[model samples]
Target: MAERDTTGAEGAGTEAPPDRKRMRSAARLGAVQALYQMEMTGATLKGAEVEFESRWLGAEIEGEQYHAADVKFFRRLLRAAVDRQAEIDQLTDAALVERWPLGRIDPTLRALFRAAGAELLALPTPPKVAINEFVEVAKAFFDAGKEARFVNGVLDHVARAAKPAAFPA
Candidate 1:
């Protein structure tokens, strides 16, 4: 989600309040990116978290501006993904078909799953909302609809397992 900087040249315009939904969506995107950075670069949780917060969040990169993220929500998602990593990975593995395990998946997809799994396990977000949000994330990274559909199916299974009460018999 790209939100342009709204301030005028002299910073005289009245900037609108941040949209809560967009901020949270940006947070999800940031968390996934941070996790992917950690996985690829061997960055520590604190290091990755700080780097994303300071350098990436709301920063224009490659000429595209990013939306301001919900910092607290971003931190929570990143921490949950790192802290409960083994558990999240286990849940993801269980959700995937036998031929494709968690480790064998694309790194970006893996990161997205970890962030989404953490939210499913630790946050109060409704499972469907989490699923939809992450499906959108998958769409952001993948050009084809196939990857988005794959993310949707896997996250759906993970959500059902993580929050059974949300999906009653």
Candidate 2:
């Protein structure tokens, strides 16, 4: 797994346990995967949330163990993404280059944007923190550094727009 922490405690020298940091990161990634599954399978929010919460949050599969996620944060992300999808999509579209509308992007990327957008829009989490968390999530899903950079750029745009004061002039 990636060595980065999404809980903003990296390099802090014991501000929080590594396991706690990893859990939040896992929540962000889980939210993205749940969102993608919902889109691809037309799963209802409740159904998908239940499935992820009960079966996948910390389950082992194929000899690989998934970290336990912050269940509340995961639910918040999933609900916000679905509850505010239209706005999220619009924000994502505005952030992307004109040639690459939100719909035209990879489905995984679209899910990533929506999850990040939800935090940027509705959560009190710092915009930069949210961006960094989701960028790391992108890295987990993709092998190439290119996708991570793309995630960072788009999320920066969304963050600036969603919380302008957080980014000072």
Candidate 3:
């Protein structure tokens, strides 16, 4: 995987444990994968939760190490994203080109928007922080590709709408 935690931007308060950061990062990635899996496989939210929660999350696999994810956070992001996917998609849809609606976007990008939207819309963290984190997640999957820039722009636009109070005059 990609080294995603060294962007030099910290969250709302003091730094979390090194382990905590790793786990949250991992959970973000896993949440994207779970959401993608759900869309592609037609799996229910509960089914995706069970599959990811049981077999992966913290498990080391294919000789790679996985930090133990923040299970509660993972569950919350997954569940909340599923519950408000329509809203998330609507918000993301507003940010995309009229000809390239959310439905026309890549499945992975769709999942990224939904997963990041869940947090950006509801989580207590700063919007910039959420944007940065998701940008990193995008980088992890896209490897500095064009998708990463698209993710940044669309998400930043969504954040301005989702949490206008978080922005300044």
Candidate 4:
């Protein structure tokens, strides 16, 4: 369900390269933020999706442009995350330690994991791809903090569990 935009806003003139795969990556990041918003504000799934489409997509904050995301992928991530939050959370809990459960994690990181878990569970992309994308998203938020490593580990664990065939014996 990937769509291509010939608008060239993604690459512009120079500097940033064309978004061959980055659009989906952007969608993942955006979906995580949208999911976080829903979690914190108790927003409905449809409401969150609309807000993203109307206000955030292609909208700017400063001077820089926001990358055009894969809207279909975003919807998939958000919908799957919303529908399977409890199951995803249970997997996250299982991946965590006894004391430091998912609730103790930062809310944003929790949202990131939830979106990542949804993608992993949905089977659209390879688990490694989804895990790597979320890990990069973690680094973007925390700048190589412990959270990034935590995300990598937990995501790898979840991926291994959810798609065991992806991992070798």
Candidate 5:
């Protein structure tokens, strides 16, 4: 349950980007933040999903298209992650060193890892693609080199441990 202030005025709208890739990137980042909020507050997945949609997708962000497809995709992804969090956490814990249990990691990083890991394990996409997308999301919110490297490394480790068959050759 992240606090919602809605204090700032909405920016003027710009031309929508024709590229779906950019839209997907924005959706993924939205999903990550929603997952992080749910993790921090112990909110139900549905509650978090609605909050994210109302705040990010519902808000009139300049130059962005909050397509229904993107909202649905993000909601599905976040719900899946929350529903299967225990299994995902177990996989993540096994991939990490004993001292670095997921609970001990920064909450934001832990949530990001769980969300990415859940997608990698449960989604139909190739594991490498999921990892790459999540790494890009990490880079946007964190230091590009260090955070992306960390996300990539941990995800690689988790993929190897939990879904070796899905790992790229």
Candidate 6:
């Protein structure tokens, strides 16, 4: 894993923006992009992992200094999502209408869905929160109404079918 540049200067005397939520959303968006690149290029898992770190660093430097905890949390979330991808894809496919294979979906959307669904099913976070976060990410990069709604609906189905135990009470 690439080390975060902890030596970087902190924003002196400046209160952090209230945009941490958006930044976190953007990080997950970045992870989806990395996953899409990996799938399209047929890169190995290690290659994809390295690419994620590199891209994340670039994003951080271009953006602001994200809290280390948030950065670390996203990295863990992305890895867990990648690790359980096959199972997550299987579950997602099963939930789809007419057995839509992941490859048949738009690659970007597929990656986003897989990443989101993997977190929903495998991570210890609440399902509704995961779905909402990913929906926000999708909205940032795509048409919010139709595409975002599609993502939300499919992921909701996956959450119910794949890992009902993780669903919100």
lDDT of each: 0.88, 0.87, 0.84, 0.83, 0.71, 0.69
The numbered model that scores best in lDDT is 1
Across 1-169, the per-residue lDDT of candidate 5 in tens digits comes to: 9975221211223232455445555667777888888767887787887787777763666866554326655765687787788988988888778888888987777888877877766665556767887898888777659878878888888878776875558
lDDT of 6 by residue, 1-169 (tens): 9965431112223332455545555557766877888888988667766766665533566557533224554565567678888888887787667756777888888888878876676555456766888888788778658888888888888878766665557
Q: For candidate 2, give the lDDT of residue 165.
A: 87
Q: For candidate 4, lDDT tens digit of each residue in 24-104? A: 778888899999999899999999999998878667868767777878878888998988999899999999999999999
Runs in model 1 deviating more than 4 A are: 1-18
Off by over 4 Å in 4: 1-20
In the predicted model 1, the residue pairs found to clash are none
Q: For each candidate, C-alpha RMSD in Å?
A: 8.8, 6.1, 6.5, 5.9, 10.2, 7.7
**Which of 5 and 6 is the better model by TM-score?**
5
Clashing pairs in 2: none
Per-residue CA lDDT of model 3 for 1-169, tens digit only, reads 8766443324677676787777778788889999999999999999999999998888889998777888877887888799888888889999999999998988998999999999887566678777877888998888657888899899999999899987886
Q: What are the clashing pairs of model 4? A: none
Candidate 1's TM-score? 0.89
Q: In angstroms, give how far residue 136 of model 5 lies from its true place.
A: 0.8
Give the range of the ten consecutive residues with the poorest summed lDDT in model 4.
7-16
TM-score of predicted structure 5: 0.77
Please provide TM-scores, in order, for all candidate models, with all chains considered together.
0.89, 0.89, 0.89, 0.86, 0.77, 0.72
Count residue pairs with overlapping backbones in model 6.
0
Question: Candidate 6 overall Cα lDDT vs. reference?
Answer: 0.69
Candidate 5: deviation at residue 68, Å? 8.4
